[model samples]
Structures are given as C-alpha cells and as structure tokens.
Target: MKASKSIVRRTRWPDSAGAPLVTPLQPSVVYASSSPDALDAQYDGTAPGYTYAREGHPNADVLARKIDALEGAEAGLVTGSGMAAVTAVLYGLPGQGDHVLAGNQLYGRSMRMLREELPRMGIATDMADPTDAAAMAAALRPETRLILLEVVSNPTLRVSDIAGIAALARERGILLAVDNTFTTPRGLRPFDHDADIVIHSVTKLLAGHSDATLGYVAARDPEHRKRLYETAVTLGLTPSPFDCWLAERGLQSFELRYDRAEANARALADALADTPGVRRVLYPTRPDHPDHDRAVSLLGDRGGPMVCFEIDGGRAAANALVEAAPDIAFAPTLGDIGTTLSHPASSSHRGLAPETRAALGMTEGVFRVSLGIEDADLLISEFRAAIAAATAG
Candidate 1:
C-alpha cells in the first residue's frame, strides 16, 4: 500500500476482486552525507554538505541545479553579479604572466577588466573580432590560456561563430569561456557548440525581470566546474539567498517570456527596416548582417529580443529620439520585459577609449532597444513619432 525509493508495486484484494493497481516511486533524498567531526574541523576541505552561506547555500544550489539541467553542464556556480561571474572565470584559469584573448565587442566593463586591470596584474590580453574565425585563430599564442567571447555581442547585436572559435580553442588546448547573457541557454546553448565554459548575467534574461542581480557560470567539464566553484568561494562572490530565490522563481517561465519578447523583437526589426530616418537596422536575423547565416545555424528560427539601430542623425539626434519616446524608457540597462532604449556611446560603452569604440564600430548614433511584451504596433508608432521629432528638431 505504501512505497518509496524507486520501486514498482502491484496489489489486488479479494474484497475488490478483478481490480489492480500499479505505482512507481522514488526516494525523497537521492544522496545524503554528514560528518560528526565537522564541528571540530574548521575547514576540512570536504563537500560534507554546505558549511557556510558564503561558500554555498541551499537556494543557490537549487538554482545551480536547475541551470545545470538547462545548460547541460556538469556543474554550475552562482555569483553576486555578472561581472563577478566574469572575474571568477578569468581568475580561476589564469595567473600571473598568462594571456587572454577576448572578443572586440565584449561588454564594456569586461573590456576594461581585460585591457586595463589585467595588465596591471601581469596578465596580458588581446582583442579580436569574434566573427572572424581566422582572426580568432590567429590571436592565439603559446601563452594564451583563455578565449573570451559572447554568444551574441552587446550593443551591436552581432552573433559570433561560437563553434569555430571553440574548435580553435580546443586545437590549441585553450579554454573557451562564452558570455551567453544575450542569448540565454533556452535561446542558444554554447556548450553544444564546443564551448568549455558558459556564463550568464542572471540579472538579464535569466531572471526575466530587472529586480534581482545574479550571475552563473556553467562548466562543460567537472574539473573546470570545481575550479570555478573554488574561486567563487575564495573570492566570496556568492549571491544572497533571497536574490537567488527570486531568480529561481523568475527562471521558471524564462522560455515562455523569451519566446514572446523575441517574437516582438522580430516584428519591430522588420518594421524599423523600412522606416524613414533609420540608417540601418541590426538584428541577428537580418540578411545583410555579416554573421546572419551563422546566427541562423546557431539560433535557428529565433534571433533574440535585443535590436540595435543607427539613426540618420548622430549622437545628439539619437539622444533626442530617446528623450522624445513616450512609451519606451531611456535607461542604461537591457534584457528587461518593458521596452527600454539606451545610447551605448554614453552609457554601456562609455568606459572604453574613443579609438577603441570606433574600432568596434560603436558609432555615436547607435541606439539599442530591448523589446518587451507590448503590442508591436504601439512600439512601431512610438519609434516613428520619436524619429520624426528628432529629425524635426
């Protein structure tokens, strides 16, 4: 009548003749272990269940387990913020005198860390165009220990050839770390394309809301996973339990939210392509985009929710348009459900040098839009009105 721990049962009673029942069950706890001497052991270096909240917590573990399932990773680690995730991955692998090769259009803070801070720490780095497979290959050197790239570049919306870069890293015995914040695991899985490590700004698409700030690092190999976990623990980069709980709740409907947001993005991109005062529309699905084919192959039918466009006017005009928008909020952040716009020149990418910004093709007129679940027609009309106002001004 009662069963547990993965068993099958069949029962029949004389009183209920000719009636049969079958049931399958599993144990409540898959595995459990605890050490009696742990009280005396200050730090036994044992995985005898979480000993401290800073090192690990139940909520974080649960979220990590969920991420591991979705990302198909051996293990996952949670961090306080996305930059903390980046820092953990970089510090986990490289030490003094090591080299790192990073994509050109990386998140601005990431670029600052690699180009400015890493050098002071005796770590060398070189930037390369992620879309250029040959350039990525050529950037590797004997001292190169890591290759950092984004699944989908920020601001520009340029999708990289992750498979090609991963293969090159494998050939050189270098670790490939991909920032998959732009394209979450549901939209695209970087590990499936040969990435050794995948990182996400859980504050972004993973949370699907702007309330919680969390980051995650998912490793393809167990060893790498352990190294990341150890680094996070040592650095005290663990996220708070409450934030982890919120992020876990947000992740439940991530796939559904992404679908609606991405669909709205596609419709907005199509509408903006032919609109007046628009110099160019940049979305991964656009035919003219350099990596459109690769994006189609990697992301398939869905391109993603973020879109970047260049207006006919320069920085002033772009700023004017953002100010004139009635519906979309002008903010520095992205990957939110409500429509938000940003001027990368002065916000996200402002930390970079002017020459470096120009080199990455981040022009002054560029404006990025993170589409939400609002009506596509309304978004288009808001943009049309904003553009007209900016041009008239």
Candidate 2:
C-alpha cells in the first residue's frame, strides 16, 4: 500500500478471548461492513451493528442499558444534556394541538421550554402544582397528552406526589413522565409509582462527580421508548462516547456516594434549622418540611443529598453566607462529590418573573445546599459559622 493508504488502513486485530472488566469506549463515528447487504441490515435494524454515531453507538447503548436496569425501564435513550432529553420527550411524544400539563415547580429551563418553546411548535402547556390533585385536574384539557414533573422540585426540594399524579394521568389516558434527577433510582423509582416515563439529568447524582453532562430517558412502554430514540436521533441529540464513559464510571460508586451524602444532608438540615439567621429549612427528612410525610413514604428514611434554607435577610444574607464559607464552593450546579451552594434567585430560576418566584416560595432569602460526602459535624460547624458571619452585620 502507498504511505497514505497504509496509514489510513491499519490491519484488523484478532479478538481477545477474555472480556474486559469495564466496557471499553468505542468512538468510531462510522463502522465497516463486509457487504452492502450487511450495511443495509444495520440501517434497517435487521442486524446488531452501528452505522453512524449520530443514530446510535456502543458506549451510549451500554450506558442506556445500565440506566434501564437501574430504573427498571423497558427501554432507555441517552442524550447530550438534560435539556436534550426534555426536548426529545416534548417533541417525540406529543404533536401539534396536543397539550402538556407540567408541574409548576420544575427546573427553570423545562418551564421555559414548555411555556415558550412548545408554543412556537403549536403545542400548548399548562403548569399546575403536582402536589395538588385539584389543581392538576383543573389545569388538564381535553387535548392533554402528557404530564411532566420532577420527583423533587429544584432548589426548593418539594417532593412530588408521583403515585397520585400517575393515577390521575392514567385515568385521563395521558402519559406520565417524571424527572427523577434529584431522588435518583436508589431513593425513588418512578416506575414503581406507575410513571410511564422517567428522565434523569445524569450530570447530577447518577454521574455523582459533575464531570459529565448527560441525560437519560427511559420508558415502561416500548413504543414511547422507540419514539424518544427516533426523536433524539433526528434532533442530533446524541451524547459523546467520552461523556457516556465518564457517566458509567461515576455510576459504579453512585450508591456509596449517595448514602454518605444523604447522611450529611440529614445532619446539616437539623443544624441549620437551629442556626440564628436561618428562618426555615426545607428537607424532606425534617418533620417541618411540607412534604415530609410524602417524602418518607416515597423515598424512605433518607431525604436525599439536597437541603434548602431561607436566610433571614434575603439575598444579602445568602451572599454573605456564601462569601463567609470558603469551604463550601459557590457553584450554581449540583451533585458534585464535594459540598456546593446554589442560589435559586440568581442561577436556576432567574428568568422567572418576581411574582412567579414568590408564588413558589423561592424568596431571595432561600439558598440551596448540595450536601457532599463530608463529615456531618464539620459541615454543621462550617454552616453555623457562615450563618453567624452573614447575620453579624
């Protein structure tokens, strides 16, 4: 062969008899086929082979299967980002003239998509409190096709009534899609509560380290799953093989990390509630939390790794606390291995109108903490000092 051809066409290696303990990453955007018939088989889904990474790939498939197994889903699809997964569902499941009912307290971007983006596509959406059955019922229309909600609301940490909402959706012949980003499968499985579809921002707890940005969609029904996959492919929402590989690695220790973080969260919640500057603490494990009973029934004894508290002096106090505590990173994101803080008024829900935020009880005083696998006592001490510093002036 010529120099160029030789460099491009390397000899194929023989397969090893032993299997790798970890799934190897396959980054090939294109695959070779022995014949045109074989290539056609791949394209038509008659054979088990990859034709293009945009449609499907080995690493993405492996991670999807792992997520499927974890969530008890019949089928799964991995996407480039959490918003991609949401977009896929919105576009894939419902059509023009079909309406969607969403929880009032979903992630800010999701709300924006349903309220603003979907309308441009001729799809309609209405927001209702997922915890209030009457509100949900009133919000539903004859054209309602799907219901979307988070298992736990962002920043505020409101535990949703999955079983109730699922039952209502079933009665109305509407599909129920639950974003299980916060609770994760270890804490709560939406399928067990009769959710038709489950979504995850694998960038969070599932990935655990905040290194990879990935999202997943899984369905109990095979047809919905297939539709989501097709939509993802059509939209070019495929994830990188490298990010999928990283997510799989993080998932390996997800349970251990989750347990440690949950423990720390429980401890910190109690300590913060008693602190001087804290007006309220919102954690499902705490009896004072509005959804405490629902959380215990749905998520068991653990309240999850996230905790929210309202500082006495609104944004000023929150800013002071963040500045005083150099130990806790002031990251707008969540689910890192180390403790971090997010200000909802500034980061997640900044786009919403002031009245809308007030309705959700997301006052400027509120600050969200993503508890890490740190010593509970140390976290408590740091938070107490931060609260004192913030309140002192």
Candidate 3:
C-alpha cells in the first residue's frame, strides 16, 4: 500500500478468467506459489506447475504434448535446437565406454557429434550402412547401447528401413533413435515401426517455416522421458517460450504445408530427370535412387519434401544454377514455405575430408533442394531454365 507509483503499476497482474483460442506465451523466468508446500510439490513433480522456465514451462509442455500426439509417443521434451535434441538423448542414455552405432548417412553435424564429440567423453561410435541389416548387425558391439538413424537421411535422401532396423535394435536390447526431421510424422511415424526414440528439428516441416529454432525428443517410456528432461535441463538446452509458441502456430498448418511441399518435390524430381546436364535425380520413390525399394515399402507413395540432383560440371555448374535462380533463395537451411537450395560440399559437409565426402556420395555437383508449396509448374520451368543457364556456352 505504501509502495512507489512505478512499483504499484509494475506489480499489477492480469486476472482475466477467459480462455484464448490459441496457446499463450508464458515467458516468465520464475513463478510464485500460494504456499511453501505448493512450491515444494511443484519442485517434486507431484503438482501441475512450472517453477522455473529452464526446468520446464507451459509453452514447451503444450508443444511437447502436441509432438507426442503426432509421433504416438508417451512423453516428449523440447530443446533449444535439433542438435540439442540429439545431445539430450546421447548424454541422457549412454555412459562412459558405451558404444553407439549410427547410420553412415546422417546430417553433417550429427556425424561430427558421433565421430568427434562422443569419443571425447569416452563413448565410442561406429558408422554402418543402415540400409544393409547385415552391416548394421556386424557393426554392433557388446557395449553398444544406442543405434542412431535418420528415417530419410539429409541432403542425399536415402530412406532407411525403420521396421527392419527397429527389429534389429529390439532383438539386441539397443535403443534406436531416429531423426524424423526430413520426413516428419506426416510422412513417417518411426514409433509405429517400434523405434524406441524419435527426434525432430522442429525448425523444419513440423513448424512448416524457418522461423523457429527448436528440437524435440520423444519416447514411449516414462523413464526415458525423465532422463531426457533431466539431461536437457542440466545442459541448458531448454527452448525459448517464444519459439515454442511460434512452432505451435506453425503446427496448425503442418500437414497442409507438408502435402504441398511433397507434391512439389515429386514434380520437380520428375522434371529434372528429363533435363539435360542433370546427371541424376535422387528422390525416394524414383527408380534411380539407391534406396528406391526400401523407400517405396516404408513410405508408401510419399517421397518426402526434398529432392536432390547432380550437376554435370561439379561445383561450377552448381554455382551457376544457384546464381541463375533469382526466385529461389540459396540458403543453407531446409523445410520452409518457399523453395530453397543448399550445396552440401560448401555448407553441410564442408568440414569432412574430400575423400570422405565422395565416399558418402556428397560430391561437389550435388544440389539438395527443399521443395515448397509454390506452383510445381513454375518451379519446374525455373529449374529447367536455371540448369540451361548453368550449362549454356
């Protein structure tokens, strides 16, 4: 009652009882309780409240629950970025001397984490061809505790046999973690195939736009979820409330965006296959793709929201095409509402040795195109013209 005028105005809190049609942003770092007992209950996880944003928050809980529903997961946690999601699972599950078996085909950052970072902590990792069940089995060690995979590997568009790999992991008591970033739940729910853990870069298809930088980790078991949460909090990987709110808005039109992008992807792949100077077009359903049969069996008719192609003249031709396509942004990211192009050699896989990149089929000529909801015909024309421009004398 005796406080200054500024303090009185700043301390005023909204007391409205009406509900909003959308999820509201709760950015408060700390929360208050009616009593010490109530605060203690919240801290002990017995009460339904968040005492700290870094530990947990309303926005993250809402988004995580939505992801759980989408992925058919029992529980989920949201983190700051896609790599953070991977980090939470890796650090949360395995301890020193434990081995991790990862698919040879993976995002560059993920590969780096396994090959470079995990080893620093005394955890060992081995790369195996996930498409070949025999190779994966052979790579497994008695100390192997986790098998990391991507439903559809980034850039290259290789589709893994989720059911087969899940079976292998289950038989061996290994926890299988699949990144569904490339093929969101709309395209494939890894959990349906018995995958123990599901991960997502919510910045991609789930959000349907490039506005949010968030990641998600989901699991069927309560203990796994608890461990992930604890690891994420301990590492300060908590997501921003604003980003979580943004992602929730994006989720409202996720399926719509995904369907349109996938259509564009298929159309673009078909068009590019017939164009000159295009050495090869890599799409999951395409007969030319290495994993064509597996893709068809696993994804049904969905080819996902990406298409890749090889230029005839390596980096020069790739650069020419990028420069010619003024309409399509040449960005180093994916899963946006508008089409974008990324050259892996100079971006994603740039850190790897040249020989290693070649072994993985990520040559200088490869162009990873993320399709959008734009007019398919328009994109086809633009790409053809751009390719012609790149190849022109």
Candidate 4:
C-alpha cells in the first residue's frame, strides 16, 4: 500500500512499553532470539531481528524506514556520514574500467571522492555540467554506468534537469544517482522523476540540530538496495544508533521547519538581490535565476532554504563582510535550525582549484545563506546593515 506523505513522517516503531508520545532511542548492538526459526530468519535476512550494530540496529532501522517512505524509495540505508553514503554507492557499483559521469557542481568532498578516491579503486569518473542535458548526453560512453548530480547544488545554487537527465540515463541503460541533501525530500524528490538513487546528508537537514553527522541513500530496487546494504556493512560505515534515533526524532518536525525556512529564504533572496556589496542572488524562486523554470517544474514553489549570492569585491569583500557581520556567524555547513552563513571559497569548495571553482560558478565572492525559522524582516534588516557596515570597513 502506498504511504500517505502527511502521516508517514509521524509514524514510528511502537515501543516495548506500549505507544509513547514520541519514539525512544534504542542502542542495543545485538539481539538474542529463543526460537530457532526466528534465528534462521535473521541469518537469511528475512526477519526484523538486528543481529549486530554493523549490519543494522533498531534506531537505524526506524530511521531508514522513515527515509524510504519520505524519499518514495523501495529501501533506504543510513550511513555514518554523507561521504560514507557516497562511498558506499561508488565503492559498491563500479570496478576497473567502469566510468562515472558526475556534475562539476558537486560538493568538494563528493568531487574529491569521484575524482581522487574512486580512481584509486580502479573506476574512472568524468566531470560534466549537470544543468546541460545535451552535454551530459554527449559525455555518456559504453562504460558509463552511473551519473552523479546534486539537486540544487550548494554555494552557487545551481539546479539541474533531473527528469531530463534521468530519461537520458535510462535511454542509455545507465543509472542516475542524485544527491538530494540541499533540497531534501521535502523540497524535491528525485525518485518521483525516475532517479535510480537519492543520497542525503541527514546531518545537515534531517538532524536539524547540527549534532548528528549521518547520511542516507535511498534506492527503489531491492537488488540495488542489497548491494548498498552489503557495501555499508563491509565498509564499517554504519550510522550510530544514537545518531539514528536523533535523526528519527528530528524527522517528525521536518515539514514545519522546512516550510518556515523556505519562506524565510524567499524573503532573503529578494532583499539580497541588489544589496550594495552583492552582485547577484541565486535562489530558485527568483524569476531571474537561470534554472528558475526548471525549479518550478521539478521542485514546486518551495525551493529549499538556501539563498546564495556573489559579493562586489570578490574574496576580499566577502571576507570583510563575513568577518565583520554581527547578526550572522561563519558556519561551514547548511540546513541547520539557526540562521547561518557560509563562504564556499574557504569552506565547502576550497579543495577545487580557483579556475575549476570559477568554471562551476563557485567564486571566492560566493556565499550562501541558510535561512532558519528566524523572523524574515529581522534577519533582512540586520543583514542589510551588516553588508553596509562591511562595505564601509
């Protein structure tokens, strides 16, 4: 039966002491069974009994189930971190001579994983512009089996043609894996567009408190799910039971938090579009955005809580503003509950060469604003004063 999106998020595993108002954390590493048939089911992966923490845990299982329903996936696997999730998929799927086509606009670690780490394992990766369907199509080769892209990329806020890319991938018998961290399942869902896998850094958004460093990869095929699960076990990159429980607890308020953040982001995008030291605003809701049309069709009205822009004087100006900003603090990551800002040049995209970063629109002047549940007018007024003061300094 199809799960209702409204109620599925609120669903949780019933507790031993009967139903509680909220789900409690389960940290047991292993389970013991008295029935021999139940033991057999655990050995064959049929039953729900968790034998070891490395394989699975109750909290992690609950988190995975929620992610599966949220992502509209057949199954979901939770991992220690976002990079772990990415590694599990890349490590499991490709081998010697297999090629992966990835977008150049990925997060620095993800780019490093594909360009540096994956090659170490004998797999080849090609970087391409995910926004360009024709370019991605031309880059596909016989050995190209997986395509990697991020929905609403970080820092520069680039949006891709998911359904178009997925269609092209499907036509070529290739798999398309989308990193849904920036937009989350609330803002956009790749599965609805026929994407093979949806990857997320649950640490950033789903956890909300910036406490849990975890990730999840959702796949609609059972066979692909088996491979991911096996890879996760072998890699020893399983998410902790406490983090999983926290993530599950955080999932309950996702709708409320996401909606408020998106609204705040929309306001900030408009206010920062023509700020004294700002060159341009890159939010999906803005009509002037290059990918605005695509975002509307694929992501609907809410385009996540990220509003990125370029400053007037490049790196120096960005540093001045970021350093002197009073109302905002310098945070390296996004999707947290507090209003925070990050400069990609020194943080997320610092690993990329200057030329490469420029090519991907992630310049030194580029900074991203992750709107929280704070009052929009208050944030706007304070940020405007901060920008003015920074420019003066």
Candidate 5:
C-alpha cells in the first residue's frame, strides 16, 4: 500500500535559462529561487508567479484555486479574517459617494463595519429586512452600488431569501454579495442563485477545525475579481501560508464531515424541540420556520450544522445549562469537530448596539449550538441532563 502524499513539498530551483539545474542542492531548500529581476517581474500582476508571502503564496493560491473551483467562481482571494474579506469586498467597488443596501440582520461585526466604518468613509448605507422583498427594494437608492446579505443570519439562525434579494439587486443595477459562511458552498452555492459574490469565514466550516482563522472572497466575474484582488493587496489582508495549508488539508474531508455534522445537528434539533423548558427550536429544516419554504427551495433537504434556541430561564438559565454540560465546551467560536455552545449577547453578537440586538432578536436566552461529529444519542443525552440540572436548580 502506498502512503498518502504530504500537503507540503520542497521544490528545486531553476537556472537562468528557466531549466531545473542540478547543482549541489541542499535538502533544506524548501522553495524555488529566482533572480532579483525575475522576482520583481514575477511579483507584478503582469506575471503569473508569486514573489512574496503577503501578495501571494503557493499554498494560499492552491487553496484559493480549490475554493474557486468549489464555488464555481472565476477567481478567489483569501484574507486573514472574515471581517477583512468583508472590508475588501465592500471597499473595493464602492466609493465615497456610493450607497449600499444591507440586510438589517447581519453578523454583528459586519453590521458594525457597514453602519460605523462605511459611514465614516463617506459611504451611505441603509438597512432593510432581508426577508421582505418589498423592503429590500425600497431601501435601494440611485447611488447604491451593492446589496450585502447573509444566507443564514448568524446567532439567530434566520434564513434569507437570496434569490429574491438577488433579483431586486439586479433590477436596480446593483451587485449582490452573500455571506455563505454558515451555508458553505458544499451545501448551498449562492452563485447558482444569482449572487455576484460569495464570502466565507474559512475559520468555520471550511477549515472544519478551530485551529486557523481565514476568510475567502469568490467573484463570478473578472472585473469583480480584479477589484477584490487589488483591495486585498493594498489592505494587506493576506492569509498565512501555514493557515492556508491547514485549510487545504481540512477541505479534503469537508464533504464527509459536513454530512455527518449536519445529520447530527438535525437529530439534536429534533431532540431539543421535544425537551421541556425550551421556548422555541430554530432550525432551517423545521417546516414551521419563517423561511422554511425558501430554505427548502434554495438548499433542498440538507440543512447545515448549526441550531439556535431559546431557554425558558433566560440568561441565568442559559449560563447554568452551559456550565452544567460536562462534555460540550462553552465557547464563543463555532465550526469544530466537538460541539460548542455560545451566548450571542456577549459573544458573536456583542458588537451590536442594544437597540440593534433587540431588533435582531438576540436576547440573553438565545444560545447557538454548533453541532459536531459526536454521536447523536450522546449529544442528546448530554443536553437533556444539562437542561434537567439547570431547571431543577
């Protein structure tokens, strides 16, 4: 039996004639070498090679290319963080006098950037309910450059009408960018439904582990790709090579992990729905959910591995439940092999103002469960025990 190929490799250098020259090469040489003139020329966009880590790296390019293929995008760019990808996309095309129509319910940090940072840059923004097609249409202005939305509202688990929003944006001659982090390309490819751009927090599902922090921006057209690449280069938001390698390694088994995690999540959601002291179960797969029909039409039968629910005892009860869970870890992050429980009011949605948080239904009792690869029965039993302990106390 043959061993699997390692993700990392060491390359031999080429001579002045661009041929692999066999000189007394050392085993420590892990990268190819080029002349100063060749390096400068290669780093420039005119050439098709990488010359620096910040501008580009072989591993990062490989990962980005794979993501591009997965998303069916013309090009893709990687960034240090999710917010960096958002910033590069938002700032790349829109100018000072431009306007943007954004979904009212967004990831807290993204909402902050749109409401706080863009305004300071002289870019005007209007928030609209993503589910209401008329409301989204009404928010568009003559100067609106883009419409940004999330496939699934973070923390709240609210699904957005991507096709409707995309239609509205198209009619108004505005670009549509969808944050597909929660509904990754494996489950839901937004580009197929009229989205012009797709952004992802690779830290989550793509990496499938909590080890690396990375983001990606995939564009469907050359112009959009050029703009995003230019902005990424200028902003210096490139991801590290090691992180990119880890992401690539994770992508190899993404399909299997995603399927298993999603199955476990559905089982957990059903169990939670029947548990006492639970106010409401928020899962995209539920037939009675607000956007259930849309989700089905867009994502088909498979829902991603995230579930949000409200506890009967509010913040104190929620905290107690988290503390009582001996197996599941209480953490602010998500998308790992082990289950993670988080409090939105102080974690993912902490950046939102009180009024905004209220509007988005991010109450203290709201808890987000990132289902992992653990056995479905074990996870349910653990949660049942935690709820029992919390309520009894």
Candidate 6:
C-alpha cells in the first residue's frame, strides 16, 4: 500500500467511465433534478447535488476533492486566484471585532489586505517577524482568532518556524493559517505540523505552468472548511470550470516538475554561493542560511523551487542582469516552467516604503529565481556569465 505520495494524489481519482486515464470536465451550470423535493433537500444541504456553477461545479468539485486528498485535509476549496482563497479564509474566520496576527513579510497584496481591508472591516491586525517566535507570541492578543504566515515568504525566501507558530496557535486557541505556495505538499505539508489551515497558490508549482490562475485552501477543521466554502460562495470567488480542469490536469505532472525544479534551485544556490559579484545567497537548504536547520527539521530532505540572491552594486547591477542577459527573463511571478528572474524591491515589495522594505531584509539588489526543469549546468553557465557582465565596469 506504500507508494510515493505523488502517485497517490494522481491515482486516487478513478478514471471517468469510457475515458481511460482522463478526468471528464463537467462544465454545466445547472443540473436536472429528479424531483422538486430532491432539489429542496440539496439546497438545504440535506442531499448531494449541485445547484449552480457559482455555488458548485463538477470540475471544481473534483479538483477540490483531489486537493483534500493531497493536503490530508478535512476539506478543500478552490478559488479564482491565490488571493481569493486567502481572502475567503480571512473573511470567514473573523467577525467584526476579531484580531489577526500576521508575519511582517508576506506577499505585497497579502500584507495590504491585512493592513487595509481588515481594519476597514473593523478587525484588529498585528504584524510580527515570523522568524522570531517570541515576537509572534508577544504580538498575540486575547481577541486574536487567527495567525497567518507564509512558510517560505515571498522573494526573500525566509522560512518561518511552522512548528513553533503552530504550537503557539494551539496553546492560544488561534487558528494557524500557513501559505504553502513556495513549498507545496511535496516540499512539506503544514497540516502535519498542526497547522489548522493550509493555503496554496495552485497557479504556481501545483499547476506547474504559467497558464492557469488558481488557488486552494485546505483546512484541518471541518467547521473551518464549511465556513470557507460558504464565504467563497458569498464572495463569488469560485473558479471557472475550464480553469479548474486545466489546474486539475496540471496536478498530474506536479510532483515530477516540483522535484526537478527544486533540485535545480538547490544546485544553483550551491553554485552561486560566494561567486564573484555575489553578496548574499539565501536558500534554506544552504548550510549557512539562518533557517537551514529549521527547514531541514520541518521539510525533511525537501527544498523549494526558488532561490534568492543579491549581486554587487545596487539597483544598477540588478537592472544590468535584465539588460545584459538576453536569455534570462524577468518575471514578477514565481514557479513557472522556465527559469525566471525577479527583483523583489521593485515588484513584490514595492507596496512597502523604501525604509520599510530594507527593515524586512529585502534590499534593492535582491533578485529571486524560480528554477525550472532545465539542465543545471546550462543555467549555471548562463547565470555565471550574466553575473560577471552585470557587475563589470
């Protein structure tokens, strides 16, 4: 019965009848009812049926079931975008006067939502350094109902203390919601460490392609799952059936894609360490990384697909990489099929003021790379040459 978890996630769903090895996409908006009473029961949650596309679509439902299996969750829900999934959880879990404690370094949009939208709705919000458990604990309040963090933060790739944070949440009766985007189930399942909720941007490594914009929420608590589903419906955040199908198809190759890319990223991180024109290389797998031991403990032997580094000279050298390297690409998003470079200062962290970003360790020269399945040697050669040319006078 023991096999690779990836194989289990892929094979858990039975093949559609008359269609071998493929899942049929159901794009219907409404389903015919056998009787009026049956429809009423379904509407009342006393029967099994889907009434509307916005409420529930077959393709999305199937994908959600698959996600539930993958994340070992009590339930899973899909949304149109990563932020939609996150926002649904935030909105559903908190009441008008509830409190939320979040990590200071999060995706720019996520940070903005907590700081702006939550307060507008009369919810109290607090931010703390995720790497410091004491700081997170100190920031908690009696009214704190939820604690949000990204396991591997945006751009900078700082690994949070998941077990520590989860423990704190348990002791305080607060729900710990972890964004498992950078580190998927393959990298590490946050729920295994007692995370109450796990959020993933399926548009990234789970889909393994840049085409689909999707996200998923996996909750360990059944009540939380029901609340999330209701909130998603109320907000009209359900994904289209077509996008759900594409994301479902993308999941088949995810394990293979994630492992290859993660290995290449670790290789690149190793090769770039202490290279000429390199000031700092931040990858949790590296022995010298501040969170290396924690990552190893939490993630086992797995690593993420992204690596972050800073080259010499300030913004000029960072810009030179784009100007001098024609082969490399500069994309704001991570976890694509191709190796792409991104500058966090101007992209992910631009929402923050200059001083605020620096205080979070996202410097002007910082660049992150989401490594693809390309040959590690070829990428090393290309980046080595580009780094030298960019830093040259």
Q: Could you give the C-alpha RMSD of every candidate to the true structure, in order shown?
A: 8.6, 1.5, 1.5, 7.9, 6.7, 8.3
What's model 6's overall lDDT? 0.87
Q: Which lDDT tens digits does candidate 2 get at residues 94-116?
A: 99999999999989999999989
lDDT of 3 by residue, 325-347 (tens): 99999998999999999999999
Better of 3 and 4 by TM-score: 3
The better-scoring model by lDDT among 3 and 5 is 3
Query: lDDT score of model 2?
Result: 0.90
- Kindly report which residue pairs in candidate 5 clash with one another: none
Q: Which ten residues in a row have the lowest lDDT in candidate 2?
A: 1-10
Is 1 or 4 the stronger prediction by lDDT? Answer: 4
- CA-lDDT, candidates in order: 0.83, 0.90, 0.90, 0.85, 0.84, 0.87
Q: After best superposition, candidate 3 residue 248: deviation in angstroms?
A: 0.6
Q: How would the candidate models be sorted by lDDT, starting from the highest?
A: 3, 2, 6, 4, 5, 1
TM-score per candidate, chains pooled: 0.88, 0.97, 0.97, 0.93, 0.90, 0.93
Regions of candidate 3 where Cα sits further than 4 Å from its true position: 1-12
Worst 10 residues of 4 by lDDT: 7-16
* Cα error of candidate 4 at position 167, Å: 1.4
Worst 10 residues of 5 by lDDT: 22-31
Query: Residue by residue across 301-322, what tens digits does model 1's lDDT show?
Result: 7799998888867778987897
Q: Give the poorly placed runs of model 2, Cα more than 4 Å off.
A: 1-5
Better of 4 and 6 by lDDT: 6
| Clashes (candidate 4) | 0
Number of the candidate with higher lDDT, 2 or 4: 2
